[model samples]
Target: MPDIKKAGNIPTSMLAVASLLLSAPSFAEVYVAPFGGYSFGASEFNIKSSGVGNLASDEEGELKVSESAQYGVMLGFTTTDPGDIYLLYSHQSTELRTGNNFSPSPITDLDLDYLHLGGSLYFPKGDVKPYVTASVGLTSMRPSGEYANETRFSMGFGVGVAYQVAPSFSVFADARGYATFISSDSTLFCNGGDCLWSISSDIMWQGQVNLGLKLTF
Candidate 1:
């Protein structure tokens, strides 16, 4: 006859798999959210047009980026603590204008993109939840007219609320800020004779507001 306790014991591997399954879907989930927004905070800087990679040139003019539409998507994995970790990607198409903000000026089209790994913490109250989030990532700056592309380290933070209408769906709106780190005097957007800008600031900032729908499963 076999020992009763030994015979009744489950295999360790079997127990492990069982624990994982029970702790998984019930305690965690994955979600996808798509958002549309307007990004403001058009940053203005001094561009040294005659420098040609020279940072000390005094011949400079004010340049400004125009505010424009932003669109993005997030892929997130929820935690047991009513929050989630997400990867975010967003883009904006705008223009770099020379001279005053309201004047008709020479325009150079530009594209800005951000990629971040981020997380959120939530305050759940009934069907509504409020959350705060933060992230660190990279920003890619692409300028037209023979300028070279530049990539810089960046950070973002935001606060928002979401309303759940079903077990796997919700809608949310949020406001966020993005700060990009730059070398104060590097030839970031210049490409030779036509090159005009060595970034004048050590940091650049922008603000955005978004509205979106989330699907969780």
Candidate 2:
């Protein structure tokens, strides 16, 4: 009876060890994810005019910002431990339209896009994960009419939360603020050969709110 009891305990211990080994490999496998969402925010265009443009001020401000739809893609790989680290890259783009209240004045359509490469540190508690991240990348702003393309080197930082709902699905929300260096150039006006103007403005900081779907693998 003593030998039978010892033999039964040996198989139980062995089964427990096997279970541990099977779950261990899951901690190191790479994870891939892609997401999309909408953005509702403001894109402030500071127009400083030279060469006969108009008269709003030495600095013209267009603050008539409206809600817009934006979409993007993201890829990330994370360590599988309960609390771990991850690196991700994502690209998001949107269109902004701004105009002055007065007529005969030129309307500006500003197309803005962002490219982000960042890393995140996550503290996961069961199905809920909270994370913080920092990213440095490019912001491209293009104005219709006579303004040249403006590209800025910007840095962003934010904190957000994600909740896993199923085996390979989650929902996330994030809000990030950008501090950027503004670089501007002007183009020749289409009306005439001599219709050329140079515009300059001070760089302004902006913020955005994003909510979307997250797919985890």
Candidate 3:
């Protein structure tokens, strides 16, 4: 397991601040949400190694993470009727296929994970609540090999609606856009002595939609 420090200091600082606010005297409620959904995106990877002498090198390829399963958990604190803060962790299993050829074999399994500190503003209307959320966090990309893994700064924005189903439980659906910023000369997908590719990109984006059950206390 890679250290959280590798993800950088910004996400850590935001989590600490949110934790402090959650412990304040005016905090109204604490809630837990478990969610599962589908995620899709076009995360482009550019080849950077000059000596590989392959057509794939020095060219751009897309990691088409399409319609993959994603799941997560959130721990939240509500301070007022319309305001809350939360920490979230999500895991996504995606298929990495060549951009040009959509083949059945040679499909690589990729894992995309995130940890975020976020806030939400809710509009309460009768028994339903609609909300908008934003977060800053860390994104980790791991391939199913001895590949070079990466952790980068990430941020997201989302909108959702929640319907109260019971006294202390609610069901919700959310859709969010998450992106990670990558630098040039980052190695990826390695094994044994040689790496599959090195990538250079300014940003990698993903779209996620989730259905969840929230429990309040």
Candidate 4:
């Protein structure tokens, strides 16, 4: 397991915000939503020799993650107005294909998951509501086949629109951008005695667009 000491602070902040919202002096409306969407991103992996005297050379590769479907659930609380607080969990499965000089034959499958705490301000106009949201969370990255897994802190913001179809049900669409703060020298993929590569970015960015149904009670 990787040291998640740095990732601990984000959850604390999220909890504080949730507590504040829950303690507000108003009647709160609770809701649950299930959503599905597409996720797309790009990451760079750099490989270097780490042994005693074996042609030391550094090679870099770019992994372009293909657009893939993602799904999640959200639980929320709203006051009398259009402002609400929510907790969300989402999952995405994608493929990482090599770019530049790297071979593109074998694509590595990646599982990405996020747990976020967020708030949104909605502008209600008749039956349509347009909203903006910001969130802080943690993201887990797991690569299948031959790569190490890691968890990192992340933050994001989005804009969305919701349409009320009935008294209790509404349909919504959201587009968000998230950036995970991974350590620059963190190991991304490795093989025993053959190769080892670390991620070369201070942050990795991912974009998502989703459509979902929200039920309020």
Candidate 5:
């Protein structure tokens, strides 16, 4: 029987991705890109809605993930058209902080990862190509301590350019953004017992910029 709990979630492991890439069609042109970059920006999750009550500040405020470094890889093949279809996996190590002040100390540490299957359409002008990319995926949000990990439906979009340095290789960079859907009832990041944050928004958003080398074979 299938686990409904994981219906839209990607496996948190790398093995499934490896197998998919390894089994690509022999005649297809495959693209493997590994990138490193920084991630920033996100709206607040209302703690009041969380029903967790105030921790320190007397004023009402929202909680959010701090800016941090992120890295990931994209593995997929070129389409028949002027586009590339690929699987993207990216990770960011960051912290969750509360209050409007957003102090240096965080409420808890968190690791954020994205697993997506998407495609990009390119505009080729000479060896330099500009493209727009989009992916529909899931996010793995793992917070330290008693908070059990949560997986939610998310999607990403980007615009970037790839300058072909060689016939089979290229260097590229993109500015991308992600949005994760949160249920309206205000339950997220739950342990079998307690849950943290109400996440009142229908969607939580984050943006990133990545640069990497792509090899096509």
Candidate 6:
């Protein structure tokens, strides 16, 4: 009779602990993310050393999203708390205008297919968790035509925050910029390997915007 109610509370606490232990495995999370946004950056077209005539000195172009932007979907699996890795399949395209120096002409468009392997680190905070992620993998670009088909290495890193809404779902936004380099031996349209008149450039860089949803198991 001294503490009948107090004795019952002890069993209640034990039951709560057992429930959490049972649910732990089911709480392991997996996320499939799809995102789309705009991309903007600059490119320099160098005149190949063996060119017949010099068109311009490393033509400066303005990056636009006319038909260009970084958008795609990715899948992720958590290997540990505050740590996870993702496989990303993304498409990025850009329109560059030869602003001045060069004569006005049709716009040159650049598009790329990226296959990325990367991981992220999450910082445990209050309601919002911030993370930094980096990826490195393969990328392909089809500048204007098929003859310029090129393959190269690509990589990117960014930091962003996500707010927890439900136990199984969270929304996130990130800003990332990436670059890749490919070598060209054919000057099909190029006066030389390093010439601007050449349909293709010796190097390329892209900046991307990422926004998407994350679902957790």
Candidates' TM-scores? Answer: 0.80, 0.61, 0.80, 0.79, 0.83, 0.67
- In candidate 1, what are the lDDT values of residues 167-193, reduced to their tens digit? 899999999999988777666576754
**Which tens-of-lDDT digit does each residue in 12-35 have in candidate 6?**
533443343344455346677788
- In terms of lDDT, the poorest run of 10 residues in model 2 is 187-196
Worst 10 residues of 3 by lDDT: 48-57
Expressed as tens digits, the lDDT of each residue in 1-217 for candidate 2 is 1343455556553344334334445544344444444545554544433345553434343532344555554554455444332333334444433355323343555566766565667788888888877777777666566646656677878788888888677787877676666545442222454322333434546665666566554
Candidate 2 Cα outliers beyond 4 Å, as residue runs = 1-46, 52-67, 80-106, 145-147, 183-202
Evaluation by lDDT, superior candidate among 1 and 5: 5
Q: Model 3 segments beyond 4 Å from truth?
A: 1-22, 48-60, 101-107, 189-194
**Runs off by more than 4 Å, candidate 6:** 1-28, 49-67, 183-203
Instruction: Decide which is better by TM-score, 5 or 6.
Output: 5
Candidate 3 residue lDDT tens string, 1-85? 2354665665566557555655656546788899999887656665544334243444555444556789999887776757678
Model 5 clashing-pair count: 0
Best by TM-score: 5
Cα lDDT of candidate 5 equals 0.81
Q: What is the C-alpha lDDT of each candidate?
A: 0.80, 0.54, 0.77, 0.77, 0.81, 0.62
> How does model 6 fare in lDDT?
0.62
How far off is residue 181 in model 4, in Å?
Answer: 1.1
For model 4, how many clashes?
Answer: 0
Question: Against the correct fold, how does model 2 do in TM-score?
Answer: 0.61
* Top candidate when judged by lDDT against the true structure: 5
Cα deviation of 44, candidate 1, in Å: 2.1
Clashes of each: 0, 0, 0, 0, 0, 6
Looking at model 6, the pairs that clash are 29-217, 47-194, 47-195, 48-194, 48-195, 190-198
